[model samples]
Target: MLAPLILRGVNFKSGIVQGPLAGYSCAPFRRLVWQHSQPAFCYTEMLPAKQICIEHGAFNRYTSRHPDEVKLCYQLSGCDPKALAEATAIVAAMGADCIDLNVGCPKAKIRKKRHGSALLAYPELLYECLSAMRSATQLPLLAKIRIDGGSNERHNLLVAQAVMAAGVDALVIHGRHWREDYSVPCSWGQVALFKERCKGIPLILNGGISGPKSLHALLHKTGCAHAMVARGSMGRPDWIHYLSGPLEGELGSLSLKQSVRWLKQHLEDLSQLESCETVRLQARSIVPYYAKQLSVDSAHHLVRIIRGSSDFKNLMLSLKKIL
Candidate 1:
């Protein structure tokens, strides 16, 4: 159902890459993905360039990687080219297979820092940052971006032209504008515009891609060979498998019992990689996502139990009772 993707000189067994999710894309979640559905590559949560440069050796959620991780992309966020360049080299030394610039994040805090979607408006500065990072390492450098909405071709093209001119290896374009929410349908038409201007750079389509139907549709419509999944894979580590190839059984989220088992291991891995407080907090969000497979009343009951749990032991106990 998908083609093998080769970024720079690295060969990904499959072309369906895992998108970088903020808090959830850390070591434990990625470890689960590796054990369940290994995609072309998995991305780490966005790492602030300044933070990386400052705490280069410290172990934290953003910079930590599991021993099982093979093809990993370290995503960096910052406005200064020099700082981004430094951080790129830092991640390279930390063993990154790819370096991605977070140009698509739309959060107000990110925009306030002149990073993320804000960079779309400053094509020259974006070029400078990409150019600097490109020179900093020999790894494949990708810029993850979104369009400027319908009828805003000029702005979208400018950013596309800037990345290409700065000599990026590939373009990972999401189908929605930064201002829009996920409820708004993804605009494959705008992604097609980028495919036309790409010249030859490999374009990876992202946004609203949940399964084989959506994945195949995006590829067929926009002519992109690769796609990334975000919310679809939350708490369901096996979500990527359905898109990687043909499936024989039930689809989407795993059965309730199976999901509860997966969540047990996921929290265990999270405990090893993060603090006790992190495990408590992450369990709250993780349970509800995986609980979606249950009946509505059952799911609500499980989520309520999980959120009210006081500690790691309580969290595990609540999850066990679900099955």
Candidate 2:
């Protein structure tokens, strides 16, 4: 039997989570995933905790969740405890079902700010941040961390222990060190080792889970409570359904024509929820993901047209012609 993942009394029936993609996991993308894939939960892109605390409208974009996104987790990144606490409170008040601290982002900008994966190097600060956030809300709190800050597995274990000790409800481990790139395979062995020490706290395994086969293998290997999909679900948001099995009334095996129609509907929904500029930018960014499913000529043509056009209607017309 597939065990459900429960965090703070909320039952995640599927145990398949949509990990936050920094620039791409915005409201429109999340809505697209929710409508098509129906992951147990979806996260917003990482928001800067300090900015969300200081700026009046900083969370507007992050908080624009779809009505169906009842299990949304707001992921926050920052080095300050006070700021994190403030931001957590605001996120909870904004109707977030859970809060996640981002400590696994390996981007240069994130590390330079001593946020994201940089926090792994300073266990004390990470604990303080988690503790503050825990005190701020009764909502489930989670920490998403890399396997190791340095090359040492011991560092990873220490960070996991500290995060759990700080009262975090769950841990999401991306099975790689901060210095390791995606080219390096994720170490599910390391995740399993960490899970052994986690006592009863739920552990969600992430990294390189591209499809159902890998997802199942990783789950069996790591004994993780859940699996979180990130880059793998890019153009194929229906991957969640493929991995978790389709929910009742969910469509299966979309044809190329149906996929194109779905893309059109996604763009239309995006336009209604976001500004024109945002719609155009998001459309351009996401269109390339569909290229792989198209013929070589159509793929190249789609990329060219999307890159050159700023108007959504014109872009859609070009896409329709190519599809």
Candidate 3:
């Protein structure tokens, strides 16, 4: 059974909530979390609602929850209220514990479609969308928003109030706006205001969270109930546990060889569930995250290892030698 976990008014099986990265939150990635980490809320890659209606098979795959996926969630992006709500209903019936509306994604395609952060400019429409979703299903609804333009504090506050009024169970705030790319910087001060406006709502903060020090600063300053991780958790599977508690003693700083061994095991598991092509892509995806922790040459070697045609066995062997 999924453990009972709650954030503000919304109850989930696990207090942990995984940040939905567009291409990376595949079944194998999510399954890894389900097995190794605490029972946590894991989101599917953002599925456009219209696509959900037309290609139900892909929707099922995107939103599919393993039996172990206790608090699985489907994140939908669209400008149409009815289509969005209808899609949410479909996934809910398919076994989603929560349905999150993606109003924070800043990707070019999503914005041009007027789906993601573009919705922030039309607050009333955003309200209507969430309200439609609220009317359609009893599953917990979450609204993810990036800080609005200009003053982060002001924009986030208004967005929070509107979403809360629309009856979302929780709010996930990315601490940066669409304009502020990841390279700029994060605004912890703005995040600290979340507890002020929506005292009863769970505000999960995202942005610039790379490790323990940042986590500690943000949590203490914001007084938020939970933290959502995005790019940071790519290769470091144990990051959440690492931040939430003390390190795993001697194994805390895993050597490069240890990392290769672990990653090879993860690759094998991924192969069982995904195509070789996908495994290769995912390996490419997480390599940079692991690369950062190693020396420059070792990092370059990791990149080569992921890109090369060697089988998973040879890849691990090569990484072991490089480390």
Give the number of the best model, judged by lDDT. Answer: 1
- Give the best candidate by TM-score: 1
Please give, for residues 214-317, the per-residue lDDT of candidate 3 as tens digits.
Answer: 66667777766577776655666666566555433222665677567656656766677677666777788777766776677777877888889456656656
Better of 1 and 2 by TM-score: 1
Q: Which segments of model 1 are wrong by more than 4 Å?
A: 151-153, 247-253, 318-323
* lDDT of all predictions: 0.83, 0.79, 0.72
Model 3 misses residue 131 by how many Å? 0.8
Candidates in order, TM-scores: namely 0.93, 0.90, 0.83
Error of 3 at 6 (Å): 1.0
Error of 2 at 157 (Å): 2.5
* Residue runs of model 3 more than 4 Å from their true location after superposition: 1-15, 57-61, 149-154, 192-194, 247-251, 269-274, 295-301, 310-323
lDDT per residue as tens, model 2, 1-323? 23577989998777878999877787767777887777778999999998887774344666677775658999999999999999999888888889999998888988999999989888889999999999999999999998853375457767876787899988988888888997678877777666677778888888887666677777777666588888767777777877776223333544556556656766776777677677778777787776665677756766677688868788778658746
